[model samples]
Target: MESIVMLSGNVKYTITLDPSVWIFDDRRQDLHTYFHEQQEEKDTLEEYTKEVSKHWDREIIEGAVVPPTLKTEKKYLKEELLTGTFCIPFKPFLTNAEVSENAKNLVIETVDGMVTIPLTVAEKMVLGFSKDGKPLREDGPIHCYYGDGSNYENPIKNVVSFKIE
Candidate 1:
């Protein structure tokens, strides 16, 4: 006879946003159109729009921290070093809201509540690495930003963390 035991643990991640990370722009309308074109039901559309609108004018930042894809790492180091990549998708919003003309005094929110940092913090976070990092394949976090981008800057700060279930 044999006996086996299984145990599992859950972890919660708190992502902090830099103050400089302000919303640069919004594309809610586009998102709404996409859903409508997809033939989504009214309730579905309303729910999607409402949920996404809450974070309207927010920025969506996606990044991946992963190891090198090449096998050359084995020859050089005993352990593989992790690398990261960051990017701002063209369409990051999911509602229909007009763009903002003012970029000052913008609030940046994340999973860990609101925080402030540099405008270029996100870009600085993922610099010096390839943007081809695969979070899904590498078991990394996929961050989404929702805020105004009127005063958005290049290379948004990276102040978020991921928790996988």
Candidate 2:
């Protein structure tokens, strides 16, 4: 299967996505745990500012203090990269593509056919690229999992590209 997919139509930018690189992306989430957790609403900008402030304070006061668990965390992350199932939520990519306000739906072009979904629903979707630390080479550049977890067991696979309409 091809490792790249494109986001095109009704957008400001045509994006070429390489799912293979997402394995190392910080935005990649653990697919198995994604659905089980309830997401809490928060002001991300505020949270980010607070974290930066804390880091700045520490840098000025303590001259940089590294957590003791840093090494352990790195080790665990390495292990996870070797064995974890992961996914990248599609919201960011769609946002970057700048979907046209007139666009009402997104058509997922697959190897065999296409599936159409509302733009709102498309924003909540997740692109699963890895399973058990392996790329989904048999039938996927990605598998799209619904935002509402309605199709977790059987996601939309064989996706080749997305056309906004």
Candidate 3:
């Protein structure tokens, strides 16, 4: 019953048949810390995604919501695109915002002719509100004069006020 074995070229070897089966003992201690950090990052990203989703949903809801059967043709529907009563495509503008380098200012004429303001991020609430300082209808379009933030040539300059009609 020899405890050591000798093999070719005078090499000696020792073998532990049971090999401690606890290889993951050290890693298990830090598992919880790793998981906690991952959860924190995940939660932060989820909050960011939710905020982005809110704006995305608003654009989608504001755009044309026509039923599937009401379409005259197979045109691609865009949440960021608006269709006027004349079937004209009108793009929106964020207040004092320039979406792209080529975006220009635009005008919005409401059907009621009650309110007209610049379409901007800061003015969203103003347009969203009713004349009596009450809440405006969320489903309908709030008319305004918008600068599309494009057209570098003129860029809708010298335009300060907008008309309701």
Best by lDDT: 2
TM-score of 2: 0.88
Better of 1 and 2 by TM-score: 2
Sliding window of 10 residues with minimal summed lDDT for model 3: 2-11
Q: Cα lDDT for residue 7, model 1? A: 12
Best by TM-score: 2
Instruction: Give the alpha carbon lDDT tens digit for every residue of 1-165 in model 2.
Output: 688899999999999999999997878899999989985545879999999998899789877678677799999989999999999889989999999989999999999899999999999999999999999999897999998889999999999999999
| Models, CA RMSD each | 19.5, 2.1, 32.4
Let me know the TM-score candidate 3 reaches against the reference structure: 0.18
Cα lDDT tens digits, model 1, 118-144, are 333321222111223322222112233
Residue 141, model 2: Cα distance from true site in angstroms: 1.3
1 versus 3: better TM-score goes to? 1
Model 1 worst lDDT run, 10 consecutive residues: 1-10
The 0-to-1 C-alpha lDDT of every candidate, in the order given, reads 0.28, 0.92, 0.26
TM-score of each: 0.21, 0.88, 0.18
Report the backbone clash tally of model 2: 0
